[model samples]
Target chain A: MSFSVDTGEIFGYLGPNGAGKTTTLRVLLGLLSPTSGTAIVLDADLSKDDSMRRRVGVLMENNGLYDRLTARENLEYYARLYEVNRPGNRVTELLDFVGLTERAGDMVGNFSTGMKRKLGIARAILHEPEILFLDEPTSGLDPEAQHMVRELILRLSRVESMTVFLNSHNLDEVQRICSRVAILHQGRIRALDSIQHLTSAGKKTGFSITLADTTQASEAEDLLSSFGGIGEITRNGNVLGMMLVTIHAHEVVTTLVKNGIWVEEARIQKRSLEEIYLDVMRQAEGDVA
Target chain B: MSRIMVVAEKEVRQLIKSRNVMLSALLFVGVFGIFTVPAVLSGMGDTGAMMDTLGFYLVLTLGVFMGYLFTAQVFLREKQSGVIETLLCTPLSLRELWFGKVLGVTIPGAILAYFSAILIMVTGSAFTGQTLVPSLPVLFHIIVVIPAFIAATSGLIGFTQFILGMRENQILNFVIIFGIIFLTTFIRELTGPEFSVTWTVVAAAFGLALLLILVTAWLTRFLSRERIITTLSE
Candidate 1:
């Protein structure tokens, strides 16, 4: 329910459809007043301090654009609102940055969803705000466009030293870019931790091994079945997959080789962010039930 | 430029580019300005007095109607599309934003009102076979008082749009359109053939307009970012 993002960290907020992610975002952006607690950004209450909003930028799901205006005009209008220095130059630079230079004169109503999202990002950081908040940044984008957006977010955080608070349902996107995350359910944070810790710090490590032939796979399966600290063993053709509870991947491979089973490949698999997120959601649902 | 002026400038530009709206506004003013002169002259007595009366009530009515039309575009459209939410996140205060949009709507509404006034004068002169000029008081009403009234009317409507939800605004829009039509008809009935434009009438109208503006500006204190935002979804 309560947490703080570090100065320049990329914090991911994950939740289901009705988990109040947007309500929290609205409160943070000063659009909605929180009922009980305070939502502060950059050490200032955005609702109370008008000037402090100048240092923060946001791109909600709507993209906040006027369809009647050209792409350039939309950015220029926001640029003037922020009082950015040399708004013309800044707008041009951003149009180029978001790869909308050729379409600058075209009305945004004619633009694709991806194009609008790109322009929205450019508008958000037009003033070089200290922190940026993006809600569903790559929601409707194609794979290539999604990749470009992900790369842009990473570049902004690393090069501009701008803190990012990304609210997204794209687990793969978050796992690729975000350093830490908070999973919220039913208006409360169910799990909050670094991606590294959540994926690897569990008691069981997912380990997989592929043998050279079906005969060798059968021997390895038999060997792993009799071995302690290994459970849930499943096989398909020459591949063996199981959960390693009390033993390490190296020890498993060493034992197989000692048993004269030719091990073609033995790999340690880290649990994915999607798995961790689903586990958290299930736990929360179980608690409610 | 100040942020208020910036917002006003963008709004003006957008209104200008809205060709359909501009065309419709021009059509409304053109039809009323040209058609009303013959009816007024045929039923009235004094030529100059009739011209002055036409200038006073018609131009004021046109200005107010223009304000009503553009206020929906300048204020309600943004709220409906959720662009206002982004504007609220900026450093500009709610008062400044409301004032800026009022100015934006007022400028265009007044310009259209001016066009309607000139059209009325030209059409009247062509029909009467003599150059007709409004009295000094009527001239003051068209040149100065009309724009002030436009600003006041648009400011009040824009304020209401910012505070009310979509369904309420839709209902308000219908009420306003009907009310303007009824007021126009009522003005025609009240101004008999013997009625004359005088300094007293001009001064009283100007005072009323100034009062409306001050009242609208005072009413803006009740506007809040939360109210505007929460109504966006509705």
Candidate 2:
């Protein structure tokens, strides 16, 4: 339910539907008050100090744009609101940054969902905020658009050194960009760790081995099944795939080779973020049951 | 520019872009000014006094109505669209946001009200077969009092819209429409032929508007970002 993001770090907050991800964001952004707790942002209690909000930026599920205004007008209005010096130039620069200079004069109501999301991101970074909060920024974006948004977030973190608090259920996005993450389930944090640690530190590991001799596939499978750490052994066309518990790929290969099985390739597969998330959710549900 | 002015200017620009709303306001003012005067002033005995009185009260009524109409567009529309959530995150205080929007609505509302006053004068002159000009009191009322009244009414409405939920705002809209209609028609009929459009009456109306503005300005202290955010339609 609570965590701290380091400076210049992209902290991904992952949760399922009705998991209070949006509600938590609203509280942190000072839109809603917590019933019995405090949310502090930028070394100030968000509920008490209104001025602290100037240092923060938010892009909610809605783009928060005036559809009647052109893209240029929408950005300029927000730039002025944030009191950015040289607002006209800033507006132009942001338009170019988001690749909307040609369509800056177009009304945002005419923009596609991806274009709207791009403009929404541009609006969020207009003030050069110390911390940016984005809820589902790339939720409905096309693959290319999603790449652009993710690249933009990385640029903000690396180039601008901006701290980003990203709330999303996109496991690939979290794995690709976030250094650390907190997974929420049933209004509680089930796991909070660095992406490296979450994906690497788990007990279950997978290994895929290809045999030079097709006849040795069954032999290799039997050899791994006889081992204490190997589980769920499956073989297909001289390839042996199995789950490893408390065992390394080297040991599996060494045992197969010792048993007169020729191993052509031995590879250790990393568990994906999606796997970690689903495992955590399943555990949480079993606990509830 | 200061943040308050920034917010106000944006509101003005957005309101200007809303062509349908502006066109409707003009059409409503034109219809009422051209049609209503001929029917009401033709039945009167002292046409000049009646015209003067009508100009006085009618302008104020139209000005308030204009304020009501535009307040919903500027304040309530922003809240409904969820743009206000982003604005609230700015350093701009709740009062600044409210006052800026009220100022935005008042400027356009007063301009439309002025056009309505002119339309009333021209249309009344044609219907009565005499050159009718607004008296000194009516002139002051149009030039000074009507804009102030518009600002006050819009401020009150904007404040209420920020504080109340969607259902309450709908009810408030109905009340505002009924109130404006009742005052415009029923109060004008109460004045007899002997009623004179004097400076005292003008001064009294100005004082009342000023008082209402102060009261509404004080009411803005009750506005909070939490209230506005919670009232926003999902």
Which candidate's lDDT is highest? 1
> What are the C-alpha RMSDs, in order, of all predicted structures?
1.2, 1.7
Report every candidate's CA lDDT: 0.92, 0.88
Model 1 Cα shift for residue A247 (angstroms) = 0.5
Give the TM-score of chain A in candidate 1. Answer: 0.97
* Candidate 1 residue-wise lDDT, B1-234, digit = tens: 888899899889999999999999999999999999998888776789889989999998999999999999999999998888888888999988998999999999999999999999999999999899999999999999999999999999999999999999999999999989998888777677767778898898899999999999999999999999888863
Candidate closest to the true structure, highest DockQ:
1
What residue pairs clash in candidate 1, if any at all?
A: none
lDDT of 2 by residue, B1-234 (tens): 777787778878888889999888898899887888977787788877867877887778888888998999999998888888878777778888888888888888888988998899898888878888888888988989999999999998898999999999999999999888898777677555667879998899899999999999999888888888888897
**Candidate 2 residue runs with Cα over 4 Å from true position:** A258-260
DockQ of each: 0.84, 0.75
Misplaced by over 4 Å in model 1 are none
How well docked is model 1, in DockQ terms? 0.84
Which pairs in model 2 have colliding backbones? none
| lDDT, model 2, position B62 | 81
lDDT of 2 at A80: 81
